[model samples]
Target: MRYLWYLLPWQFSPAVLTVCVLTVALYLRGLLMLKRNGAPVGFWRPFVFFLGLAVSYAVLQTYFDFLAQHSFWVHCLQQLILHHLGPALIVLSGPVLVLREGLPRAGRTGAPRVLREMRLDWLRKPLRLAWRTLQHPLIAPLLFVGLIFFWLIPRVHFATMIDTRRYLLMNWSMFADGLLFWWVILAPKEEQGSAAVGYKVRLLILPFISMTQIVIGAYISLVPWQLYPIYALCGRALAISPMLDQQIGGLLTWIPGAMMSLVGVIVVLRHMMREEEAQLRMSPLRAETPGSSRPSAEVA
Candidate 1:
């Protein structure tokens, strides 16, 4: 326990703190409105959201951040938490549904109404365009895969580590993209609608996306030379050598990261099966076609 304490330093990042606080506040406000309106708000939704925020804080503001700065494996662990697990939990919580439901109706006079008015359609054009692009079947999966490759380029990865702005950009982009990718996979059928990627397409694409992670991970793990020179040069915080650390990082990306996509695939498969069963149930029972012996078709 004492050793664990030493591993987790109490670091305060104002920016990260602010974001977490605001996210919690908004979620709480929405939850309260949902309850007041007699909406069926589940306890699990808020729990999942808070859990994600906690994971993000742990990665960004705690000793994890310190270790990540020195250890490639630790950094990979941080990235996985931030970009895969945390974002998946947050998306599952359905923050967009909560926020949309929480907002006041137009022409109403209240803080909620004022906030609603602040949406500013013109200001949202770029964001809307980006969202639409992300929702595209091909674009979302490709972007997810591309982002992994793009940042892994030694020069790009090292540059991000050295520059504060670039580091922040990298982290934010990872989190945002992760959220979007998972959202496409997990959002309800009605929510996905015709505009977004069809369920079957997403399921089909998932394996390919997962394979990319596996390939990247295998490459990093097997390569004899260190890809990121900074990690090699820096004094390692842990006893592991830089080369071993790189291998461990590669393994992390290869295994758990690929598993993340497999989990999505499983979810989609189950959903599709349920939909098929439902359709089977809902289909009208067909009358026996001119059969002399059969009276009527049994009800489904």
Candidate 2:
């Protein structure tokens, strides 16, 4: 029983539980359906999808969340997983088609109908406009970097640290923004069509994100006084001094954030290379037959 406590949620949230459960159920059911239809539901993608979901859930729901509340470094790690690692993995898994397939036929058909019948169809145009605005190439990256800085503001951080609703909102915003930003960066332009941001543009945006994180993390680490004293009052789960806690948290934010951007650059390079290879393959080959009059140097 004592050991069982380790698995229980530090603070239960019905909403989080529902979202996680539904996500898993939908994915698994869709995966099964895809397998039946021979839709090439590969092992790695499902494994990665589940791994991302598991890590995200672990950070938010398990006893680890209790430590996160009382330790700055823990919180930083939690946010890293929630806002970066988890979302990146999930996006890489290419779960969109599977999740769509997982939906009930009634739901797939009736959702838009229900919205129109409810007279909320009027909202679609404005909602799409808002999405387009937020998803603008420039705005998306800026918002992604801005959220990291915003939640770290001392006063704002303090408020979120103590207030459950605000805290949840902060976490959710990071996660949702992460999904949006990574999708823009990683999805093939072919899929996104006109909305797609080019790999070259994403390369530029990633560095911008890294520099801002470095600036803030350096500030937090170098400050003589504690930037986040809330952990001290919360009965720090770790035995480290406040300064050490702050520094560790700062390092976590600084190092991992920058590394994530670097990794993004590498992924972008791979995408560019893949496209180049495809183009080369498709380009007409000039094979010279023995009867063809081609210079030896040119043929070589």
lDDT of 2: 0.84
- How do the predictions measure up, each by TM-score? 0.83, 0.89
Candidate 1 clashing pairs?
Answer: none
Least lDDT summed over 10 consecutive residues: which range in candidate 1? 291-300
Which model scores highest in TM-score?
A: 2
Per-residue lDDT of model 1, residues 151-216, tens digit only: 888999989877878877777888888888888887656565444556688788889888999999
Off by over 4 Å in 2: 106-120, 283-300
Top lDDT prediction, candidate number: 2
- Model 1 RMSD vs true structure: 6.2
Q: What's the true lDDT of residue 290 in model 2?
A: 39
